[model samples]
Target: MATADPSNSSSAFAQLTNILLAKGGYESDEAWKFVEDLFKNIDGKVLSSSSSVYKSVADGEMVVGLSYEDPCVTLEKDGAPVNVVYPSEGTVYLPANAGIIKNAKHMDNAKKFIDYLQSQDCQDNLGLTTTNRPVLKDVQIGDIMKPISEIKTLKEDSEYVIAHKDDIVDHYKEIYTSISSEK
Candidate 1:
């Protein structure tokens, strides 16, 4: 997971939490209420998102975000395995792609950068350091990160990126503005 910048808009945090909860079968209103309640009196910014929340919860912090309610129930009691579950609700998948501009002067440099990024050494480093999934077929991620083979459900029915890119961007911008105004 990326290190969240404290300066980032709260709306980004809110939207991230909202998406996770909605996907995890929690009602949107209820999820927002939970967020509000969780951070009601806190002064320092709390990490708010499924990934960060899961990490925080795993580390024994009072974090709240989307997950299988059962996972939370178990973690709150049994305290074993410690996995974060994304519920099988309305999950939206966002697949990323890399492309170059139609007319680029630094085409060679771009290709070199992409080639370097796809190298085995780079992939291995990325796997150990961040949430980046290796795109190269031959790159072995080893035990540092969760293997793609282990994530059967995600492979089976991953959501494609939003079809209406412009609309989605506009909607998120509006949401960010609305939430930031309250801060």
Candidate 2:
């Protein structure tokens, strides 16, 4: 299995943590224990970036990866043999939000940008040109990208994630370091 190094990609690391916690029914306190056992038991590869994880899988260097969905969809659309699985235990979907800041220097431009961002034309472009799952329900996505409604999403506990994020990063680093040293 492959994963992004925690220090290099905290967002990817957070996603992986969400998967591990949900999949094994492990609490925040026991995250370290579970992560340690995972790396120790599995043939794990910690890459520098999320892209590296996908590249490893694509090159057949790794059988599976705890990576993002966008690249997988992109790869599949390009005819690469890849199976994107949303863990049955549940996985979090990262939502992108856009808003204009208060007292902006260019209020008119900001409004225009926000309007353009919300427009169906832009949303459709996001869905078609990129692997981004469009927020607009009416926008059609690429053939390989699964609709958000089709995914079994995990109800994120924002407070818990925010509170434990630092601890998760620290423990992951320690565990990864220890495992790397042992090898």
Candidate 3:
């Protein structure tokens, strides 16, 4: 199995950490220890980038990878003999976001664009064009990707994650570096 390096891919690291935290009963101290212990014990690879993690799996360099859903689905569609599974304990859903810049010259156009992003046509089109799941229910998100409703998702404490992000990243890096050095 492969996991992303936290220094280069904070979002992926955070998502993975969030799931670990949830599975460990949201206990920060114990979760941190568990994460460190897993890294120390598992004969796993730590890829420098999240893309590398998925690519390693698809290319048969690694058997399992912790990566975001969309690319894993894409790899499966490309017939890489990969399987995508949402952790039954719980998984994190990191939805892509769009926001209009404040004081934009074309306020009306910006609003229209936001509306278009949420439109049924766009939502449905995303299902066909990309692995990004549609926000609207009863919309197709391709055959390989599971519907959000079907997945057991854990609610992340965003504020806490945000507040401790830097510390968390540093701690993870420390553990990773220590293990790599020992090897």
How many pairs of residues collide in each model? 0, 0, 0
Q: Which sequence of candidate numbers ranks them by lDDT, best first? A: 3, 2, 1
Pairwise lDDT winner, candidates 2 and 3: 3
**Tens digits of per-residue lDDT for model 1, 6-91:** 22533343344334345442234554444344333342244544446445666756444444323344454455335544434333
Candidate 3, residues 1-183, lDDT tens digits: the string is 788776679656665566566657444667767777777765435678888989998999888787888889988888888999887878876556889999999999999999999888998889877887877767767777777888988877777767877777787777777878887
Whose TM-score is greatest here? 3
Scanning candidate 1 in windows of ten residues, the lowest lDDT window is: 153-162
Q: By TM-score, is 2 or 3 better?
A: 3
Candidate 1 off by > 4 Å:
1-64, 67-82, 86-93, 155-161, 164-183
Root-mean-square deviation of every model = 9.0, 2.6, 2.1
Q: What's model 2's overall lDDT? A: 0.76
TM-score of 2: 0.82
Model with the higher TM-score, candidate 1 or 2: 2
Ranking by TM-score: 3, 2, 1
